[model samples]
Target: MNPSRPAPLTRVDGSPVRVLVVDDEANLSDLLRMALQNEGWDARTAANGQEALNLVREFAPDLVVLDIMMPGIDGMEVLRRLRSTGNDVPVLFLTAKDAVEDRIAGISAGGDDYLTKPFNLEEVVVRLRGMARRHVAAAAAAETRLRVGDLTLDEETYEVVRGGIPIKLTAKEFDLLRYLMQNQRRVLSRSQILDQVWSYDFGGTSSVVEIYISYLRKKIDSLGEALIHTVRGVGYTIKSAE
Candidate 1:
């Protein structure tokens, strides 16, 4: 890794960040994919707007490099549809058009950034790094304080509360609960939990996930409507109590 290069941003689940490159130009899309992978992101490519939309749903990319002009369903319409569906994934528009009006139109269509064709590769990486920084900052501000039903967890202060009552937890237990709350309502397998919450040096097996979960349940679920649930043969999920 280059010492000066910004560290790769990770998904909320602590997995590698995913990026989608959309373009009709196969060579350009391939180049961008290779560059992003070099940055340690999981990158995919789509050759048209429709394919891009399909991949957005299936891959759930953290960012998209979208081309403005395509044969069917142009990038503008794709972005419009995405925003309509409340998918606010950051979009960087690529266009051969360099007119002032064209740039304005792309930005107005909810593009987070714009780049013209024949741009420098390093410049693209720098712009993406800037966008990634802003995205992480915004998410950090929002997720520093998390809430689900009457339960709350503060990442910065390491606090957990339920129904207006403060709940005490050990460091490991707090980490487990924070991970669960971060992915509220999403079923998380034991392996996933182990990867995110435990260090590589941890000598325990997958059973440790269950042990920490049980500790959290005694502190959190025992107090109220049971925010944590076990999905038979799958794993666990946490959600707002109904």
Candidate 2:
């Protein structure tokens, strides 16, 4: 498998995760598409709020990357409509406006996270991964099982299965696996994982995330079917062999 594109993320029942990117800037949209694709996520793009809403109904994405400013409906209004419809898919707001009020407004409008413009792509990917992880953790209680293609994670027993075989993971490995499984197809920076999973502020080094990722790769991807990919100059993602 190519190192650039990993495998797709699947539910416990084996359904792929879908993502929607809404931005007026074509270049930014393309960048997001590339980043998400590297993670094996099925991502679609919309140039404006109206187009975003249209795709929301059709694609039913697992997550949304929404830009606040737009020609017509705007991100806040679109989020309102989504919430009105009871579609609680996580949304990460991307906008040029970086004010406390703006952040509050975005969150108040049902945004799961807020990212300012001119931000690092790694940061965006990391925040999105966190949102996805939280969403999956919530659903894990009900599902009791989580699987992506041939790999399976049992929430009840904390067991992992690959190609119908059992795999052992250390405590940290298990936590990392759970985080990766939750985020699945979204790129996660080493610093971001350290912050979320480690529950501490990360210093200026990525050695920890890299080391654990290496450990995970040995156990999860040593069999030729690569599930973890490194995005050069960015971060890593847990995706299926693509």
Candidate 3:
């Protein structure tokens, strides 16, 4: 019998991993994009730091390949702004300088990893996979109590409450809610929800995500201004009602 293939790495919401490749060199960015796409990941390229910053919001990449030396904003300043704004997306720095100080500065500026120039593309892919895995694992492990507005979920006690009213949920429902709460305002594709909350081995389809989302809405949204929301043509998100 053949061994089953491993599940692909994904965002907490189960979407294809997104990567932003930022470098002044167009050729290098193009090459990186091709490599990432070959790995079944989405990749976007930015010519400079400013463009990189813009794409971060528009693309919402899970990881960033930032060039430390840029004409304007530079990688360090870019990393600083991202960190300051509470954006903890993992970053890998690319630098032409091989000095110890250069590597240290990149790390000090909040880069998760750094690669010197003329590095191997294969190595880049390996490091990025590692970072993506670590980041996802860290996000899953770091939170116990997730809150959005007045709604809260306690991972330890498996309790869910909204506006001080306790809500009961089945085990699957609880897992679904926890995944959504963990992702907060981020739109979670049905496929993402299915993969993370219910395994393919569980003999379920993406429709199960929709059904449970409906269940969650009836139980939780019915109590308040509706934290559970549907993003048309995309998926769902749990956000504070405006």
Candidate 4:
């Protein structure tokens, strides 16, 4: 374990994150299991595809660190079976197959991310942490609507309302406002907003960000208690007064 590597999360909820490491190599499986346990997770190991599937049913892990090549029922097949049954558990593939096509195949077959063999332990830990974070965030984002005090944004209908009044916004303004609301209370710099709202190739300046932010404020904050706030010289943050 590298000293400078980021630490794994303590847990998502009250219980530690559960991980199932599936690989035919006992040494590799053992190493990963020990490492994950050290990171304060409930880590289990599966020697082959059959064992991996069994654990998938029994352990119901939060993450599956799987291998591609195995003697029987291979990693890809196991993943396919899991997906076929509507299991969307996050999986990180550990494989020697580093080619682009192999990666595509793994991803197309439902792997979340892949790490080539001879991987750095720190890299594995970082990827696992990132995957965990994304899994948690995505689950939260699947909500149909978001509310902050009197303001409400419906994801399915693309509607915004404040204090029982409907608010209309342009497509760009809606996107920007949605981003801000999703990450409510987190100050987002102009560059970050541009990248997310306008995408990476918008070729716009910071002034554009300022203009749209003002537009959102007028629509969203004009009627009700202000939710959009500017952190002078830093960026913008949105939080409900309630």
lDDT of 2 at 186: 88
In terms of lDDT, model 1 sits at 0.89
lDDT of 2: 0.84
Taken over the whole model, the C-alpha lDDT of each candidate is: 0.89, 0.84, 0.90, 0.88
Tens-place lDDT digits, model 4, residues 96-191: 989999999999898999999989988897799788778767655657687778888888899988888999988898889899988999999998
lDDT for 156 in candidate 2 is 88
RMSD of 4: 13.0
> Model 3: which ten-residue window has the lowest total lDDT?
1-10
lDDT of 2 by residue, 131-206 (tens): 7667766665768676766888988899999887788999889888888888888888776788777868555554
Q: What is the lDDT of candidate 4?
A: 0.88
Candidate 2 runs further than 4 Å off? 1-9, 144-242
lDDT of 1 at 232: 89
User: What ranking of all candidate models by TM-score puts the best one first?
Assistant: 3, 1, 2, 4
Q: Which is the leading candidate under lDDT?
A: 3
Using lDDT as the measure, name the better of candidate 1 and candidate 3: 3
Clashing pairs in 1: none
Ranking by lDDT: 3, 1, 4, 2
TM-score per candidate, chains pooled = 0.65, 0.56, 0.66, 0.55
- Candidate 3's C-alpha runs over 4 A off are 1-7, 142-146, 159-239
